[model samples]
Target: MIRLPASIRAACVLAVVSALAACANRAPTQFYTLLAPAEATPVPAESGYAIELLPVVVPEQVDVPQLVLRSGSGALQPVDTRRWAAPLGEELRTALSARLSARLGVRDVYRLASPASLPLYRVRVRVGRFDSVPADYALLDAGWSVERRDDRSVRTCDARYREDVGAGIDALVAGHQQALARLADDIAATLRRFDAGGCPDTRT
Candidate 1:
């Protein structure tokens, strides 16, 4: 039997202990995505155009993979154990794409070559502020615009949505999802009135 020397064996034992300690101390990360809620029947777009949803502009503080939650005292907390399934910006864009396409019954034409004959509405969203507070609410404030590709017509508007949440990570994520859904609702309505000056009334 070829056995290790005493010093080498001791060092090997120490290394094993360190690795096990790291594994024990490190918590498993949980990923979450913004999902569309069950809505009413799908309605075809009034303009019969596909959507070119640009990548969302998320706030710098919450743009990372971790969830940046707001504390009761207004301090920001980035929880590493609770992370987004994708980059925060992509997650927001994906959620909007799903909800908006479903609502308008159009396909997402992002980064795809669409024939010039097809009408396309380019939608852009920039998040001014985002806050997630457990047991309180998730707030999303964003300025979004929709531009008609052919006529260069545009509708620019900003909306702030808040959804109350229970105390937990899942509830917090669900709140944000609902908030984004509301934003989608307004945007969808505005798309129907592409050339209108005022934004849709989301009150109720």
Candidate 2:
């Protein structure tokens, strides 16, 4: 057995105590979300539909759980203390799915069992950029494609959505929510016009 001197043992004990105290005093991590509580939205008068929104693919730069903030100098900063409730990609899908379902009054049966009864539109989204400039703007650039399950008709489109933001984390997240809502509106519009005409070059 190796025995330490009294002074060295006391120093080790003090160091351990200090480390524990530091950890205890650290601030708690806070989680943020781009989701609003799902509410019962009135079904569209034209016709009801169902959607299968696939897992959204986020950019590699912001694919982490931490919220990525863009600086004025175009640098990306990941804030560890503030994080998303889930991975950024999954979070994006959840937010978009809820908004889209509400906007179109459709069921999102992405992973639901036995969803063969209703007509389904398989929606896939790939996010090119998700920029968060605190108190400035929240921007989303994405290319999404929609395919009708029955007839295999497909439409691919690219869009950008930017929302001006106020200060604070909640405001930033709210800005993102608005941008997602705009995206959902465009998708709903596309679905509405899928059978009637060609794709519209709508920019947001």
Candidate 3:
């Protein structure tokens, strides 16, 4: 083996140490998904109206793959270790779809696609704000609309929901799920009213 200069050998050792330090300092990423509670309610047969759930629109501040936490001073911080299993918007959309489908007792609910020939009621949700303070609370402010395909009639609604965060990240996530479940319940009620030919109520 050839003898190396002292400076070069020191540089090589330093590089190896830095690489090891980086690997040791890096945090492992954790993934999470939202889930709805199981219900004992039975599914309704052929509600005669097909429902289409459009992709959810979330605020730019929190529409990320990582979990967002709001600071006491109102700054938003993304946690690198804790992350959403999917994009945050997609997760919310899927959770809402499942909740609405179950609550409405209809199998005709869909996301992104619907039968063209069938009369469809399209539901669109825009989330103005979704954020949580760790161990404090999770808040959601959202506006939604339902439009009738045949009559071209539209009904818009808005809701604000908050759930207390009890302990850790699991509690924060559970709070968000509860808030979303409440939102879905409101939407399902509106759909039922619309199906009954009643005018939409915009009040939350």
Candidate 4:
């Protein structure tokens, strides 16, 4: 039988202990995604006008795949245990597309990719702020623009929404979902007005 030297045996035992410790200390990561609102009414057929939704842009502070939370002192912290199911920007675009499609009753809502033909309206969204503070609130501040492809006319809008966060991470996510749903409602209303041939005067 061959025997290892004392130092070699000690090193092997230390390596095994280190490996076990690493496995024990590793935390399971939880992933979350934004959900679209339930459709109360059925969506209608295509309106002969399609909408091109651009990729959503988020602030650098919260652009990571991990869930970012704002502390009371305004410091941003990434929660290692909780993370986004996908890139945060892509998730926001997907959620917005679903919400807008249902709200506008249109079937031709495009995101990231567009049809060969030009769309009637091109929508772009930029999220300046998106974060949650534990037991406080979740916030979403965004600026958006809707442009008429034919006339090249554009309408810009900004919205800031906050939802109260309750006890757990689930509540925080729910708050973000609610905030996004409300923001979609506002944009949907604006799109309806544009379709009706009534665009509001540009703000000063």
Return the top candidate by lDDT. Answer: 1
Better of 2 and 4 by TM-score: 2
User: How does residue 78 of candidate 2 score in lDDT?
Assistant: 73
What is the C-alpha lDDT profile of model 2 across 21-129, one tens digit per residue? 4654485777988887665677554345688999999899999988777765576767666789999888889988877766776888888853667788899999999
The digit string of per-residue lDDT tens for model 4 on 113-190 reads 545474578889999999776556789998888888888987788878888766456778899998998887777777
Instruction: Specify the highest-TM-score model's number.
Output: 1
Model 3 Cα lDDT, one tens digit per residue, 77-141: 67667789899888999899888777765554563466667778889999999977664678999
Question: Which residue pairs collide in model 4, if any?
Answer: none
Q: List the residue pairs that clash in candidate 1.
A: none
How badly does each model clash, as a count of residue pairs?
0, 0, 0, 0
> TM-score of every model?
0.82, 0.80, 0.79, 0.78
Winner on lDDT (1 vs 2): 1
Descending-lDDT candidate ranking: 1, 2, 3, 4
Ranking by TM-score: 1, 2, 3, 4
Assess candidate 4 and give its TM-score to the true structure.
Answer: 0.78
The pairs that clash in candidate 3 are none
Query: Which candidate do you rate higher for lDDT, 3 or 4?
Result: 3
Displacement of residue 20 (Cα, Å) in model 1 is 20
